[model samples]
Target: MASKMASCIFCKIIKGDIPCFKLYESDKTLAFLDINPLSRGHALVIPKFHGEKLADIPDDNLSEILPVVKKLVAATGATEYNILQNNGRGAHQEVDHVHFHMIPKPNAEEGLGIRWPQQKTDMDKIKALYEEIKARM
Candidate 1:
């Protein structure tokens, strides 16, 4: 089965059933300004094929999403940007499908602060972590 949403909000936008402040598009991909943007020109890029999660998507379909994002970043004149993807309810993924949020921070914009819980780690433990990953290889 294809990973897609018949009733998904994005699908509606792609189908032109809903309106979006669009910036760019191709036969396979769509780019539009996020309605509730983190900042101005915040855009969402998605494949026409809808997938609930990243692993559920085909490689070629996933590949098409980013080049469109790069084009938006350059067109918007954003010097720095972030590509954010979320998955699962626990991950704060409000949208179920695989889409990339391209957030641009022009010179005047304040960078979003990531709130991370603090944890203490010893050097030996950190080194053991690297060794463990290497062992898997």
Candidate 2:
């Protein structure tokens, strides 16, 4: 486990030190509308505690997020939605604090998506990676 962070945007928001369009808050979680939204009702749900990446987050904090995400989805009246979690700068994570983007994509007509490139995989390498991960588990 890592130590608590300072100057984290999400933590500042939770502390009322930073202003945000808050949608929901529990003892350890908060949901707020995104200022730079993909769509009109796009929002972010996060743990009140700072976790730079998904793996850094506590299970209890993680569990609190999905329920709030569901509420945000329903409130937006979206038929379909995407849950986006980013862990590093390479993954397009602008913020270091752990967060889930509950983006409401009603259809193909609107929302965030880039061309997802596909590639062929080597079966041997795939098997080796799987076994390595399973061993860690």
Per-residue lDDT tens digits for candidate 2, residues 1-137, read: 23345567787788898999989998989999999988779999999768789898889878888888888888999877788998899899988899999888867776677678888899998999999999999
For model 1, where is the 10-residue window of minimal lDDT?
Answer: 106-115
lDDT of 1 by residue, 13-72 (tens): 889999998887788788888888777678999887778888887888877787888898
Cα TM-score of candidate 2: 0.89
lDDT of each: 0.81, 0.85
Name the lDDT of candidate 1.
0.81
